[model samples]
Target: MYRVSLFPTRDLHLSDLRVALINYICAKQTGKHLIVRVEDGDKAHNIDGKDQELLDIIALFGISYSHLYYQSDNFKYHLQFASTLLDRKKAFICFCPDEKATPYDGRCEHLSPDEVLNNPNPFVIRMKTEPISDSFVIMARNKYPTYTFACAFDDMLQGVSTIIQDEAYLENSSKEELIRHAIGYDQAISYTHLPTVHESEKSVQWLLDQGYMPEAIANYLLLLSTPTPTEIFTLEEALSWFDIATISKDSVHFDMEKLGFINREHIKKLSDMELSKRIGYACENIGKLAKLYTKEVSTTLEIKQKIDVIFAKKEPLATFEAESKLLQELIFNAPYFEMFDEFQAYLLEKSNLHDEAFFKPLHFWLSGSVQGLELALMYPLIKNYLKEIVR
Candidate 1:
């Protein structure tokens, strides 16, 4: 059994990434119980609907977690631990207001519990940390021994043997280890921090604001930590791939081009039948999105119907921009390819060139894009659509 704990933040991208790692791990090691502990001590971090949504999304990826532990459920325990440390003189309730407390001040550690309780100003609990030794590691900004004292204790109590997290949190590993030592619960857990998600600056900012499909985001996260793209062959793929030892401590930038490339690969992996379903889904989604597009664009289902034919590879149509000047000139004289002879003659004349070369002129006049579905399919769809246009 391996205990894993995390503070599930609202960044769906990271949450999904962690889920993917966990699922991958379980699949690789059959029959190992993976426990999930949610760190919700900071009431400020609690989101109303997001936590459940995150759990559901993670489940969608197939990581079987044996127990879901909520740190909030143990707040009384945290307070109790605080009291123990206080009794042992290892911690104290600090009367120092947050604004006035600093590493230099150390005001809280020196105060008596009675003085702290009686003073009753805005205060918080503080650990009585030992002076910096060569052993101390800087986990984050200011200079506590790291992982905050409370976080390490919980990791011990929960028996977390390993942690797979984002690279941004690597240094926290050492600090956490140190805190475990201070509390004398000191068995070590392996740490693997994966790279951060990367995307183009503009797209990243936009995704941050508008959000993305939960499935797609989760899929993308799996891509981030998996050994290879092929590792995600099926839903079962998620449970078998977690290995904390392999995660790199580097920030993974969210690259749009890379994402587009991955999207295309994912698109290709769908079976033709699945593609048909996705085409339908895309149509529905596009219909909703049409309201946001420029009015000049057609909002009719008819256009979507025409476009989906291309996606299905049934009567695919190359965009008009793809057509060559010469092909465009040839197509300009006549519209529609009803006669096999005319279509054959056109293909024969363009035979000297590549298939893309043949479609250039025709594509230019029809779809207005340079490249897309096959000519065999596209030629007929556009011809049929144009005939409709004329009628």
Candidate 2:
């Protein structure tokens, strides 16, 4: 069985990342079981939906974790450990609130468990931290007093040997080491701290100034770790590259426009018929793709008008306006032709450019949106119908 743990502190985002890691790791190392534990020991700092939504999101990724553990579920264990340290004069029970706490309040450290027990109003168990010495180094603005006694024991009991975390947590190693000693787990577990991925600092500052979509944020994060950065691949190639180890640590900037461009590129690579089918499917879901130039349901009749005559030898227009001012202008301005007959004869004379020119109007007129099936594919259906009609 593989034991994994996360201190799902205040944000679900971190929890989701934890789940993603576990899912990825499990796939790479098959025949291994997975266990997930949430660290919610700090009830005071707890956030809503910490349990249910976190579970739901993890499951949504389709990873089947064998066992799930919650820290709060083991509150008695933490309390027991805290109690043992207290009895041994290793930890103190403090009743002080936020505003009045002091380092030397030795009030609780010195007080016997019984004494504090009798005088208790509301008591929070605080582990006795080692005195301020050269040992404690400041990394960020916050001063970290390692919980040597608790963290070590927990990590060892959980059997988590390698930690995949961010570098910002490097300073916590001291406390984790202490806790490791407290629990008597001597086995060495390698720690690989990943770089913090974020949009550029400037982009983050800009987001703070304006606003952004959470989906956009997640999309950016996924792109930061997207498997294929340069290579354009088909569906078959994509399904083969779903490994979690492929994720990168470089922070990606958030750009909805860029996301749209990438998605359009992906959609464009599909063949016309496939593009039409996918558009229909996308339309059913969001109705965004259904509303196109053709008032009708993009049937063969409408598609043919332009897609068909693509290879025709002549421009068959029955009416000037029916061909649209744009197409009319192209034909009228032709240097080789003086009249309609001359234009048709001239176009028919060049078989190579004939089909291409016929497809141009429909390709240009329909599918204003970027990247999809070629418009020419639909021309065969409506070409004959538009034949003398546009004359």
Candidate 3:
């Protein structure tokens, strides 16, 4: 199993999704279990219901897991392992009062058993700096098990054979390996460190709320600095071709423009009825109108906004106000025609106005925009709703 550990301390970010995708792919590619472990051990930092929200987001992106757990649930095992390491002399109880102390001076490493028992000062459990690893706390002054301590033992206990972690945690990799080694676990654990996606204001939820489809987001994320057979694919489809080794070791930046293009492509793939529903109507005509907006926009919200402007009543520009009133009056009394050309020819003859004078104000009156989908093509679709469109 390759497990993903998420801390419920902050809002979920792109980096979290990257790691989760790697962990999920590894398990599916090997016929093993995908374990999602919420590292919510720090009670001071855990958010309310954020853990469940995180899982819901993952599901929204279509990532399924074989197992789910919380790191805090294994508190008993973490402490038990700490005592086991202390008894084996692979770890020592440190009396160092400085919580920020690092590269420890080994002052308390030699206290005799009676001296340790007689001493009343509070202390922490630190793994001995073997030739294999540096010294760090397995238990902190607050009595909470440290991340490395819990993660290392959990991997061992859960039989996790691979770990895809961030490059920032490169230093912790050896410490975790040492913890397992000192505890006599010889099973090889593969470690692949990926460069982190730097922090940004746009989070995963932010993208969703902006009307970017989940598939498009996943598609863009999986394509970042990674070569694949195609530019667009769903999370489920990516399972067939994803390879963690192909990911670039150098840090990658988020490209909003590239994601916008991918999102546009995904939007175009939607059916007419589905597209219309996104804009708050079920009629295929509205959906057709929505698709026309796709030529200039990518997200569902943008397309919906454009289509909504057609029906929202608005006054025409001052220059065209008189002509628009004439056009609206003409449309109100005019009988419905199946074709736009017939409708336009009739208006031209009745109004006795030339093409630009007639069409520009007519366009502005119908959709409240001087530039957009050509009036002729859109007229037929909005014909039945003339009473509502004419005002």
Q: Cα lDDT of all candidates, in order?
A: 0.49, 0.45, 0.83
- In angstroms, the error of model 3 at 118 is 4.3
After the best TM-score superposition of candidate 3, give how far the Cα of residue 366 lies from its true spot, in angstroms: 3.1
Rank order by lDDT, top first? Answer: 3, 1, 2
Q: Write the residue-wise lDDT of candidate 1 on 336-372 in tens digits.
A: 5686457747755754445655545444345444454
Report the lDDT tens digits of candidate 3 across residue range 1-391. Answer: 7888877887778888888887887788889988889998899989999999899998888788888888988999998888999999998888879744866777888889988898899989888885323578889978889988888988888888989877878888888988999988899999998878764568888988888888798888788879999998877788899988899887778888888899988887888898788769999888887777778798998887777777888775678777877888898789888998899888888888776778788887677688788887788678988768777
State in Å the error of residue 229, model 1. Answer: 9.5
Q: What is the TM-score of each candidate against the true structure?
A: 0.62, 0.51, 0.90
- The best candidate by TM-score is 3
Q: lDDT winner between 1 and 2, please give it.
A: 1
Q: What is the Cα-based lDDT of residue 243 in candidate 3?
A: 87
Q: Judge candidate 2 at residue 300 and give its lDDT.
A: 26
Q: For every model in order, what is the number of clashing pairs?
A: 33, 22, 0
Off by over 4 Å in 1: 3-9, 15-23, 99-104, 132-150, 178-187, 198-247, 281-375, 379-391
